[model samples]
Target: MKLTPLDAPGYEKVVYAEDAESGLKSIIAVHSTKLGPAAGGCRMFNYPDLETAKIDALRLSKGMTYKNAAASLPLGGGKSVIMADPNTDKSPELMQAFGRFVESFGGMYTTAEDVGISVEDIEEAAKFTSHAAGLNKGAFASGDPSPVTARGVFLSCLAALKHAFGRDQIEGKTVALQGLGHVGMYFAEHLHAAGAQLLVSDIDAHAVAEARQRFSARSVAPDDIYDVEADIFAPCAMGAILNADTIKRLKVKLVCGAANNQLADDAAGDALMERGIVYAPDYVVNGGGIISVSTEILKITDEKWVDRKIEQLAETTDKILTKAKALNASPHKVADQFVEEVLAN
Candidate 1:
C-alpha cells in the first residue's frame, strides 16, 4: 500500500490500499473526523490515472464531511475509490479484497454505495467487516440508496422552486433532465407527475428511448441538453457539469439535481449565483439515500420513519435558500455557513 497526502487543503489523511490476491486497489481519503466517525460510500471507477483517482477521493471525502455536518448527521466525512473498471473488475474475489482494505481502517470510516457500486457490492464488502450499510433485511431492505436519494433531490428541487418562483407546484414548468439512470428516471417520474414538462438526455440510448416513450419527453443530445430552454436543469448523471463552460451555456433559472460534486470548482457556485441561478447545494439535497441507509443500518424499520427524514430534506433546502436570500449571499455560501456552525458545535 502506498499513501500520499493530497495537496488540496483540509484533507489531512489520504491513503491508497492495494491487495494483490483479490486484485483490488483503492484509495481511502479521510477529510475530517472532527464531527464524528467518518462515513462515505465506496465508489469503483475506471479512473484514467492514479492522480485523478486521488483527487476524486479527496474531494468526495471532503464533500461527505460537509454533507453530514450540514444534514446534522452524527458522522464525519470520508470516501474510498476503487481503481478498476466496474463492468469487468467486479468479482467476489475483488470485492472481498476491497473489504479487507476497508477493514484496515478499523472503525474510522464507514462505506456504502456510490457511483459504479451496487448494493450487492456493499453486501460483498460486508463479508470482511461490519462497517457497511444497506445490509439489513427486516422491513425495508438495505442497499441501493438511489431511490431515496432521488426522492430527496426531487423534494429539495421543489422547495427551491417554491422559494425562488413563489410557487410550490411545478405545473407547466419545463425541466431539462441530463441523465436517465436509476436516480434520474425516478426523479423524472416525480417531476412528470407534478405536471412539469420533461426534456431528457443520456449517454445510453436505451435509457433515453425509454424515458422518451414513457414520459413523452423530448430527447436532446447530451451536450445540447445543457443549452435547452427550461425552467430548471437537473443533472443526474456525473459531476463537474456546472463548470465555466456548461454554466456559460446554461439556459435555466435554477440548477438542482442529484449529481454529486456538480460544481467543477467552488467558484462555479458563485458563477451560478451571478447568473441569477438558484443553486441548491448538491450534498444537502442528495442526502436522502444515505439517511435512509443509515436508518436501516440502525434498525429503524418504520416506512414513515424514513419518509419523514426524506421529507425533511425539503425543509432544509428551503431554509438554505431563505437564509441565502436574507443574507444576500449565494446559496452555497449560506450552506457553508450553516455547515461551519454545525461543525463548530
Candidate 2:
C-alpha cells in the first residue's frame, strides 16, 4: 500500500492511495472538521484520470460537509472515490486495501455506501477497520441509506411544490426522473404512492424496465429526459447533469433529487433561477441518508430521533425556499448561506 498527500485549498486533507497487489487506487478528501469528525460515502468508479478523480473527491467531500450541516448532524464532511470500475476491477482484496486507507484516517472520517459500492464491500472493509458505517449486520447497523435519501428528496419535492405551485401533494403531477438507481427507484416508489406520474430514464435498461412495470412510468431516452415536460425533474444519477446545456433544455418547474453536486457550477444555479425553475440544493434536499448513517457513527440508536430529523429537514427546505424567494436568489445560494451560518457558530 502507498499513500501520497496532496494539497487542496479550503479542504482539511487530501490524499491518494494505491495498492499494487490489489490494484486499488483511490483518493479521499476531508473538506471540513469544524463541526465534527468528517463522514461520507466511499464510491467506486472508473474515472478518466487521477485529476478527474481528485476533483470529484474534493467536490463530493465539500458537498458532504454542507449535507451534514443541513441535516444538523455533528459529523463534518468527507468522501472517498476509487478509480477502478466496480463491475470489472472490484475485489475483496481491493476493498480491504481501501479499508486500510480509511483506517489511516484515525476516526476523523467514517464511511458508508455510495455509487458502485455495496453493503458487502463495506462489510469487508469493516473487517479491516471500525471506521465504516451503514453495515448490514450489527446492533446499530443502519443498512443502505438509499431509502432514507429517497424519502428526503420526496419530502423536498412536496416542499418545493408548496413553495412554487402552492400545493403540498404531488398527486396527478408528472415527474421526469433521471436515473433509476437504488435511491431513484426508492424515490419512484414514493412518487408512485403519491399518484405522481413518472417519466423515467436510466442508462440501465433493466432498472428502467422495472420502474415501467412497477409504476407504469413512461420510459424516455436518457438524453431526451431534459425535454420531458413535467412538474418536477429529479436527477438521481451522476453529478453535473444540470449544467449549462441541460438546464436550458429543462421544462420542469421544480428540480430536486438525490444526486450530489447536481450543479455543474454556481452559474447553473443562477441559470435555473433565471428560468423560473425552483432549484432545491442537492445536499440539503438529499441529506436523509447521512442523517441515518450518522446514528451508527455517533452510536445513537434512536429511530424516532431520525424520524424527527427527517421531518425537520423538510421544514429547513421550506425555510430555504421561502428565504430564496424573499431574496430573489437561488436556493443553493441560500443553502450555502445557511451552512456558513451553521459553521460560523
Candidate 3:
C-alpha cells in the first residue's frame, strides 16, 4: 500500500497500521485529548483509494471531538478506518489484529462499532483489548447504538422544526430522508410515529421497500431526494453530500440528520445558512451513539441519565439556533463556537 503523508494540523495523533498476518491495514486518528481520553468508532469500507479513507478518518475524528465536547462528555475524539469491505474481509484474525493495534494506544483511543463494523465484531475485537466498546456481553455492554443515535436525531429534528417553522412538533410535516440505513430507518420510524410524512431513498432497494411499506413513505430515487419538496431534508447517509451542487437543489427549510460530517466543508454549512435553511450541525445531532457508548465506558446503567442527555440535544439545538439568530450568523459557526467554548474550559 502506498503511504500518504499525514497533513492534518489540528489532529493530536495520526497513525497508520498494517498487519500482514491478518491482512489488516488501517489508520487511526486522534483529533483531541484536552477533555479526556480519545474515543470513537472504527469504520470498515472498500474505499476507492487510500487517500479517501485517510481523509474520512481525519474528518470523522475531528467531528467526534466536537461531538463529544458538545454533548459535554469527558472524552476526546478519535476514529479508525479499515480499507476493506466487511462483506469479504471480516475475520477473527483480522479483528484481533485491529484490537491489538487499538490496545497499542494504551487507552488513549478507545474504539466502538461504525459503518461496516458490528456489535459482534467489536465484541470479538474486545477479546484482544479492553479498549473496545459496543460489546454484547459484560455489565457495560451497549450493543448497537443506531437506535439511540436515531432518537437523538429525531429530537434534534423536532428542535429544528421548532426553530425554523415555529412549531414544536412534526405532525403533518414532510421529511425527505436520504438514506435508509440503521439510523435512517429508525429515524423514519420516529418521524412516522410523530405523524410526519416521509419521502425516503436508499441505494438498497430492499431497505427502501421496507421503510415504504412500514411507514407509508414515498420512495424516491437516491439522487432525487434533494429535489423532493419537503419540510426537512434529513441526510442519514455518508458525509460530504451537502456540497455546493446539492445545496443548490435543496427544497427544504430544516436540514438535520444522523450523518456525521454532513457538510462537505464549513462553507457548505454557510451556504445552507445563506439559503435560509435551519441547519443542525451533524456532530450535535449524531452524538447519541457516543453518548450510549459512554454509558458503557462510565458503567452507568441508569436510564434517566441517558434520556436526559438525549433530550439535551434539543436544548443544545435551541441554544445554537438562538445564538445564530442573535448574531445573524450560520448555525454551524455558532455550533463551532459552542464546542470551542466547552473544550477551552
Candidate 4:
C-alpha cells in the first residue's frame, strides 16, 4: 500500500491511497479540525474520474464540518472516497487496505459507513485499523446508522411540514422520494410506518420494486421524480439533485432528505425559497449518522445521549426554519450562519 499526499487549499489534509494487490484506490480529505479531530464516512463508487472523486471528498468533508456543528458533536469534518464499483470491487483485502490508509492519519481522521459502504464492510476496515466506527459489534459500537439517520430525516421532514403547511403529522401526506439505498430504504420504512403516501424512484429497479411491494409506493423514473406532484420531495440519493432545472420542475411544498450537499450551488437555496418550498439544509437534516459515529470517536457508551442529540437535531431544524421565515431568508443561509458562529466562537 502506498499513500500519496495532495494539496487542497481549503482542506487540512488530502491523500490518495493505492494498493495494487487489493485493488484499492481512494482519496481521503480532512476539511477541518477547529472543533476536534476530523470524522466522517468512506464512500465507494465508480466515479468517472479521479477529479470528480476528489471534488466529492472536498465537498463532503466541508459539509461534515457543518453537519457536526448542527448535531452539536465535538468533532471536526473529513470524508473519504474509494474509486471503484462498490458492488463489484469490494473485497476484505481492499477494505483492510483502505483502513490502513485511514490509520495513517493517526487520530486526526476517523471513518464510518457512507454511500455504497455498509456496516459489514466497515467491520472489515476496522480489522486493519481502529479508525472505523459504526461497527455492529463491540463495546462502544453504535451499530449501523441507517435507522438513526432515517429517523433524523423523518423528523426534519416533519419540522419542515409544520413550517410549510401548519402541520407536522406525516399521516395522509404525500412524499416523493428519490433513492432507495441504505439510508433511503430506512427512510422509506419510516415514512411508510407513519402512514405517509409514497412516490419513489431509484436507479436500481429491484430496490424500487421492493419499495413498491413493501411500502405500497408508486414508482417513477429517476428524472421524473422532480415532476411528481406531492406534498414533500425527499431526495435520499446522491448530491446536487436540486440544481436549476430540477428545482423549477419540483411540485412539492417542502423539500427535505438525508442526501448531503443537495444544493448544486448557493443560489439554489434562494431559488427554492422563491418557489415557497421549505428547504431543510442537508447538513442539518442529515446529521444522525454523524451523531451516532461521534460516540465511537468520543468513546461515549450512553445510548440515550445519541437519542437526545437526534431530538435536538430536529429542534435545530425547526429553529432554522423559523429563523429563515422570520428573516425572509433561505434556510440554507441561516443554517450556514449558525455553523459559522459556532466555529468562530
Model with the higher TM-score, candidate 2 or 3:
2
- Pairwise lDDT winner, candidates 2 and 3: 2
Flag regions of model 4 displaced more than 4 Å.
none
Query: After aligning candidate 3 to the native by TM-score, how far in Å is the CA of 226 from where it should be?
Result: 1.0
lDDT of 3 by residue, 296-324 (tens): 88788787888899999878998999889
User: For residues 119-235, what per-residue lDDT tens digits would candidate 1 score against the true structure?
Assistant: 888888889877777664445456578888988998899899976688877889999999988789989998888899999999889999899888889999999998999999998
lDDT at 136 for candidate 2?
90
lDDT of 2 by residue, 1-345 (tens): 899998899999999999999999999999999999999999899999999999999999999999999899998999999999888999999999999999999998898899999889999989898999999998899999889989988888888898768888799999999999889999999999999999999989999999999999999999999998898999999898888999999998899888999999999999999999998889998999898888899999666988888888888999999999999989999999999999999
Report each candidate's C-alpha RMSD, comma-separated, in the order given: 2.0, 0.8, 1.8, 0.8
The per-model lDDT (C-alpha) reads 0.84, 0.92, 0.90, 0.93
Model 3 weakest 10-residue run by lDDT: 1-10
TM-score, every prediction: 0.93, 0.99, 0.96, 0.99
Q: Model 4: how far is 168 from its true place, Å?
A: 0.7
Deviation in angstroms for 279 in model 2?
Answer: 0.8
Residue pairs with clashing backbones, model 3: none
Q: How many angstroms is residue 157 displaced in model 4 relative to the true structure, after the best TM-score fit?
A: 1.2
Worst lDDT 10-window in candidate 4? 294-303
